[model samples]
Target: MAQTVGDFLVERLYAWGVRKIFGYPGDGINDVFGALNRAGGKIEFIQARHEEMAAFMASAYAKFTGELGVCIATSGPGASHLVTGLYDARLDHMPVLAIAGQQARTALGGHYQQEVDLPSLFKDVAGAFVQQASAPAQVRHLVDRAVRIALGERRVTAIILPNDLQEEPYHEPGRKHGTLHSGIGYSRPKTVPYDADLHRAAEILNSGRKVAMLVGAGSLGATDAVIAVADKLGAGIAKALLGKAAVPDDLPYVTGSIGLLGTEPSYTMMMECDTLLMVGSGFPYSEFLPKEGQARGVQIDLAPDMLSLRYPMEANLVGDAAETLRALLPLIEQKTEKSWRADIEKNVADWWKTLEERAIQPAVPVNPQRVTWELSPRLPDGVILTSDSGSCANWYARDLRIRRGMMASLSGGLASMGAAVPYAIAAKFAHPDRPVIALVGDGAMQMNNMAELITVAKYWRQWPDKRWIVCVFNNEDLNQVTWEQRVMEGDPKFDASQQIPNVPYHRFAELIGLKGIYVDRPQAVGPAWEDALAADRPVVLEVKTDPEVPPLPPHITFQQAMNFSRTLIKGDPREGGVIRETARQVLGAILPGGRGD
Candidate 1:
């Protein structure tokens, strides 16, 4: 008796050591899911509330385990839902194989139910998009190729299986392809060492009056090399937000993230530097980089395509970061006595002073940024934090200090709202024993598939002792959008108080069997968080905040200056009263530290 192609595909998944598959089963892919079920304990299918969450969970699994994470979707809408996670995987260079179910081969291009061009939709995001042919051998080959592309290239790959093709009888001997390996063992490329180029970099470092290192995500595997390079050159190191853990942030030589949410010290150093050595970082904000004649930019990257795209580069070295950095360390003479490092350290001190001033001065119904920054340090070490899109994402990126082995993942490019719940579930799933907390906004959470909270509840039921907390900064409005509109259009009508219907977030939390704590006062948040984290299962801490608080990007902005002056002129009138109260509490905390320069 011949087997179905779907059955053969399940066997291949088992052969490749994929023990679990995360997805939703639908009419389009019922045959495959059924085959997955019949395969018994060899492979388990974990159903997700939304296809996107399944993709995100699978993406995180790929990122953490270095294996091919798998997710599935049915035709049309189902496939469309998976695109966001696929984009996230593509941008982060994660390995994932998304098996999307297409309409039957006969109805593929015709006007049939849920029929759409799967290959065309997925072309831009996938490393390889395969449409399985009628032959079982073709199905086998496509699966193998997808798995290889995903695992080998660290990219998202897709394979579409037609309904009839999946159910069709298999005729060929299902020859198993080689299992994918997920280790970083890149073969050394043929190379002639650029002696003069290496020496020029060394000479520049040796001769520079002030040198600053800007690190990026590509330096993840080579952090030690970056640290050594910084130490050798007496250079202060700053990082892109994604590269927070690339170097120890608390190090005296280290400042903060450099971009729109960057610190004064970091921005100052970039402006003051004689030489800016970019190691394995691709900073998207070109404005943060010093214009020519102010500082010279030298970039080192493994990918030739990304070289000098953000800033005009004086030199580009294509090589392994660790090897190249190590080689340069020996050739470069130690800076005997550079005052630039001291100046950077002093600037960092000044920046911290400004942050302290802003934080210590508190008011009633406190600013969300102040509360977030204040509350972050209170969380336990190794606590996993997942942030939602909007201003909260920027706040956490600027304020939180990540320790080693601690995980923080967010939407890189798509910046999707409601990412917090799914991302938190995945983080907790990946690190079951640790405390997982997701910081989300009430408005944004509404957009996410909330039924996934049932999965969170189910996972909590399965493991009752775990601590998975969701902190909702319930401002009762889309405050980030309001602020952005204010910045872009000077629109006073965009204020959150003018629009939005109230949704009781705490009641929603109870619907999912999670404990809910509601804080009307800003001072109540810290203890509420501590209590929530002490609970056995997942808890939601709803913090009521002022929606009109000044937007706190790192730089002291013209918008902020204008807003503050306007507020002062208006005498900071009280409507909601909570808004001013909140600002006052935060301002009180900041008053002792003195003003920002």
Candidate 2:
């Protein structure tokens, strides 16, 4: 049989090492789906309930595995639904290839069913490479180029397949067929800094009395190099949220995370340091970093544009993190002073104690921090964890420590809510041998495609050795947004649009044939997690938590404090409880004692 355009494209994808494609089917792209079917087990099609979830899964797949992720959708709404997830991939610098089917060529510019300009739709997110296969011969080359660009740039690339073109045969009188099969290979280029630049960076580091390192996801492969640089300079390390797994948090001078969801120790360390060394991270929050002119900075990054994007730098070395650090280490002068390192270590230790005290504080409904605190120690080695955006993320950022061999991430740049469930689903797909867990708030789970739980139930039996746990914080509030509203606008307790109708997520999971565990009290948090972990199938452990508890920033501004006071003065019903909780948090920070009532 002569090869069709769809078959040729699928053949190229298979050759490029694409094992799975996540998406939904529609009439516009039925021919591509047919090609996928013919490919058989060469490529598995993961059918998601929504195109958005498919995009999220693909983004997470790339994030967790460091491979090119692929997702497909039909015309119009199907293609449009993928915008948000594509943005998530683009912003997070994950390599993803999105394929969308277009209306038949005959209907171009005509008002046809499900007809939308796909190239214009995806221009912003998939702007790196967006092209349509208008002719049969273009299919193979476009697919090859899209894959290469996505892999090479670590950005999203898109290909639009019109229905008519997908069915056309790829044959010409004298032209050789199957050229795509012979010429499909992708290799990432290694980048390193010049000797002079490395020396300049080292000189800046040696001139400062106190040094600090800020690592981001770009430092994932350069963990040893990062630690070596820090140890040589007696520097404290603060990881950006995306770089949480770059190094283990148990290291003496490693401050957990820095940003709005940062730890107090990390904020303190950044403020006190005279020199800052940034590695593989473009952390956007500049307020959390040292003020300009306060610290001399040196940054090392593979992308030239990101070298000094966040903080001003005296020396910017454009190179791979591991290679750059390896060269810079020899030029750095070791610091003998232990006082700076010791001070930061003491602060980190005290901060952990404060978190522990807050986690176990007695309340009518359970404190959400306790969920992460108890879950932290119980996590098995090499587990993959994901958290949703909201109050749940704050707790996960502050409470959960990423130990050696473990991996964690979220919708960091996009800060989308419904990401945790899809991210967990993708992580499980990528690493079936490792345990997968998702920490999501009640608001985020229901806002998007909670039906994705059904996808989990569908695929649970396929990977019997793996366990998937979804820990839901059921506070019946869009708690993060509620707090933001109060703090930013000084508003009284108004539930008009801030509250979510409480749903029994555990029962919902049970109805879908997954194990369910519900905990309404603090005492049940640990056992419920244990039970869910031991369950043979997928499980949803829903813990009811207090909505009144705010996820206060590490350093509260004077305006934020005034906002809280105004809210209390404006006759908020929870005024007394809020004051007591605030007092407990303040006491936890200042006192040397462990748990406080």
Candidate 3:
């Protein structure tokens, strides 16, 4: 059997530890698919319903496994479909490699069918590393470089293979045919801040009486180091959404999540802190960050450019999160006064009480927050939860407490919908024994790839256990955007644009040969979840929820408050309902024992 360029590339991918590839088959890359077929169980080709889902699955695979994820597509439309998912990986700093097939070499500059400029198309998403293999001899080197760069830089990379070159024999100069099996040399080196920069950051931290820490996804590997620093300085810890798992919410001094989907305690602590130590998070939304000159800042990141991108820094320590924190631990001075920590802890406790009161409140349509709260306690150890963007993200961020060993992720940077389903699919594929759940909104679930539930059904028999659950928040509205339009722009609710027709997602799941559970009452939320968990197959628990329940920010501005008043005056029918709900929440928070009537 003669080794073709496609076979050589697949072999290299195998050597690089890629056991599976996510993509759809297309005519343009028939040779590559042929090689995949010949690999003979050495690698699995996961055929997604759409090219976009394939790319998303790859990105999620990288995020969950911390390895280079691979997705293949044929030229033109197939390649174009990969843009959004690749951007999600690029912006979120996940390592992914996209391989696309190009038209034959002879078709170049001839305006052939399905011919598009792939380099220009991928420039924005895979700009970090994009190359086209022009000859059979170039395949191995290009694959090696693309994988190395994707892993080393934590960014998306692309390689294009022309149809003609893919089937060609590899016989470059001194190398004999079929003799290129040597491994590529690539290793990620540890980066650490210099002694002087570490000292400066430590001094900045020790100088403040009230210090705070803002953690991001970058801090995942350095949880202990971050906690140690916070303990030493008596600092309050707040997480960026992607860093939700960086620390457990049970920690008294930890403020769960910051920004719009944040808690009151986190907002108050950020405003009050004298010094802010940002670790591995370039959290945008500067309005939520401490006001300029309000707090001296110190930032630690693997990339130098991200160190001071979000806020001005008194010291920028450019190093890996765990490495930087480990080096800075010995230099930081311990704080004796615990008043600042005590105040933040008190607020956090009160906030939890408020959340509990809201979660249990009964409504005609189930309160969406209750779904997350009920599901939280039932999560098995080390569960992997994926949340879709929109209103569901708000409840997940605020109410669902991520205990140690549990992991959560969303489209933090791209903020895209339709990722939760693919993310759960990839998570389950990565760890079949672990429980995987996707908290998706009704609007998001129907967008593009919800058919992936069928994919789950196809693969269910292969796994030892069925631990995948898709809890769909079936509120018939693009609820988050609707609220934003009303509050930010003072627009009246436009039903034609904002409302989505109700869907029976549970029924759809059953039709696809999976377990289905539907809940419309508050009392059913918990039991529905239990049934889903106990099912012997993949499950979809469709929850009918109150769309009128606003996801108000922890701290609403006077203008936003006035906007709601204006909407109410303009005959926005649901405004009154939300107002009453708001009053109940306020009374619940202030009443003795944090109880509501």
Candidate 4:
């Protein structure tokens, strides 16, 4: 039997080092699915419950592994469903290639079923490369370029395969006009600024007394370089949410996370700094950064477009984070001043204490912050952590203690809900030997994550380490938006849209062959985590948490305080709980042995 175009596409993907693909199947993509089957596991296809989740898994896989992530789907809705997840990859700068099947070629432009205009639909998300294979010869280069471009640019790409054409016999591009052959393989190059630019960057950084540094996802591999730079400049390092794992929280000078879901120390540091060094971070929201011209800034990034985007920099060095920092280190003068360093460390210490005080303060059933606080010290070595967007992210950002060798990520740029469980599944699959965990909110769980538990059930036994866990913060509300509406919009929580049905999430887990641990008491949070860690199989640890506990920003504005006051005056549905919890949060930091809302 001769090979078909589908076989050639699969073979070429395998050659480009694609080992796993996350996607849902359909009749439109049956030919390629057949090809995947015939290949006999050279590349494994992990079926997700939905195409969106599959795409999220692919994005997370790229994030965790630093390799190209691949996802596939059928036509029309299948292809369109991938847009949101693909945008997650695009915005976060993850390398991902989406493969989708189109309607039969003969039906093109005739409005056939599932014959959506895939190119137009994917043009934005997969803007780097989006092509459909019309001939067998065209399939090879399309596969090669799609994979190469996605990896090279750290962006999303796509390949559309028509079902009928995929069944045609493979053919090499004939030696004629308009026919060309393309090859596989791409090795990332060392990118560093020239000696002059590196020196200029060092000069700007070295000239400052109270220096501050902000790191993001781009700084993940440059931890050592970041530390050296921070130490030499006597700078306090503040991690953007994506850079949570870039530097361990154990570092005294490290001021946890920065931004809306940020720490007070980070806000203080940015406000007070005379100079700033931003490395490989596209942390939006310039208000959180040093005011324009208040601090002299120097930035280093691989993409020139992203350089100095958040803040104007005196020297914008275009290069990889580790390489550029390594090159600039020799010229960077070490600051002997201990006062500035001491101030940052002191603030960081105080902030952690405040968080502890806040966490210990009780709520209706359990404090949300307490869940992560207890889990922090218990996090095992080499564990991979993921969090969904919402109130849970606030706790994940502020409370979780990420030690060295631990990896953590979320839907950073997209900040999309319903991604944590899928991200955890991808993390577990990428490194089956390592423990994986996800922090999720009830809204996201009901939206999509509950279905993904089945995906875990299907594949958990295959993983070497069965310590996979998804901890659900069962707050029966769209907690983040509720707070945003209250504080940002000066509106009370609208129960009609914000309320969610209470779910027996742990019971659902137990029914699916996974271990289930339910905790309603604050004290039980720690022990429940302990039980999950020691479980023989995957686990779903659900905690009934208080929704009224606000996810306050690092530096609350006067307007936000007023908004909260107005929200209460307007009579929020949960007015009593809101006032009680908010008071407890505010007073907990000041009062001795303060506990309970």
* TM-score top scorer: 4
| Candidate 4 or 1, higher lDDT | 4
Task: List lDDT for all candidates, in order.
Answer: 0.72, 0.87, 0.87, 0.92
Off by over 4 Å in 1: 127-132, 171-200, 463-465, 493-498, 556-597
State candidate 4's TM-score.
Answer: 0.98
Against the true structure, candidate 2 has what lDDT?
Answer: 0.87
Q: On residues 207-316, what C-alpha lDDT tens digit does candidate 4 reach at each position?
A: 89999999999999999999988988999999999999999999999999999999999999999999999999999989999999899999988888998789989999
Residue 260 in model 1: lDDT: 65
Candidate 3: which pairs clash?
none
Using lDDT as the measure, name the better of candidate 2 and candidate 3.
Answer: 2
| lDDT accuracy of residue 256 in candidate 3 | 92
Sequence-dependent TM-score of model 1 = 0.87
Give the lowest summed-lDDT range of ten residues in model 3. Answer: 583-592
Which candidate order results from sorting by lDDT in descending order? 4, 2, 3, 1
Put the candidates in TM-score order, highest first: 4, 2, 3, 1
lDDT of 2 by residue, 405-486 (tens): 9999999899998999999999999998889999999988898747999999889888855589999999888888877766
